[model samples]
Target: MKDFIKVMKALSDPNRVKVIKMLQQREMCVCEMQEALGIAQPTVSKHLKILEDAGLVQSRKEGLWVNYRLSGGGSPYAASLLGNLKHWIETDPEIIALREYIPGLQRELVRKKQASPAETQKKDSSAAQDAATERRETHD
Candidate 1:
């Protein structure tokens, strides 16, 4: 009963459930999750921590990032609950949208986006300049 309640509480949040759904498709890092969910890094980490404590998710350090995925082996209750959840929420529109968005969410892209703000500003300025050049060329 305790295990069941813990699992239920871990899955209580919509964001945590979304994280589970996303993990079902592929492993993801904190930055990728932040970008996909449009949530802050700290919030995503908190959700991941909850999921981990419930034995529903596991993490491994790879290079500079900590990758998270659904735990395939854990307490029987957690494993069973995870298996059922895979088939349970496939029809939700929010879940469907996340599924569609997952394929394009690469870890590297997220890392680049999370780069220093100055670097991002420079990239943005360069892109604007290129766009202006293209417009001028088209007008000539």
Candidate 2:
């Protein structure tokens, strides 16, 4: 019963439902989901966490990204819902639009755009150091 309620609660939000719909298509990182759903990264992550806790999704570590896919099933409720979801919402305009938008979401480009200010600054510093090193080598 608790599992049933948790799954229900997890799916209560439209964004979360859209997430399940997106995962049904392919595995995606949070950045990709954010771009597709037009939501914040942290919000997307929160949605993933809820979905994971409800056994609606699973994740794997791939290099720097954690990719999420629809879970095979943890409980009967989750499995039943996952199965039903495949046949549902396939025709809604928003769902159709989302599916089309997803393919265009380049994870690498999204990640680059999502880089923190500190990370960007560090990258800039690294590039400057590389230029200085090149100049010094040329002078020698």
Against the true structure, whose lDDT is highest?
Answer: 2
- TM-score of every model versus the real structure: 0.82, 0.87
* Tens-digit lDDT track of model 1 for 39-59: 999999999999999999999
Error of 1 at 100 (Å): 0.6
- Please give the distance, in angstroms, between residue 102's alpha carbon in candidate 1 and its true position after superposition: 0.8
Mind giving the per-residue lDDT tens digits that candidate 2 earns over 1-140? 99999999998999999999999889998889998989888999999999999999999999988999999888999999999999998998989999999988888898888899999999999999999999999999
TM-score of 2: 0.87
Clashing pairs in 1: none
What are the candidates' C-alpha RMSDs?
Answer: 6.0, 1.8
**Best-performing candidate as measured by TM-score:** 2
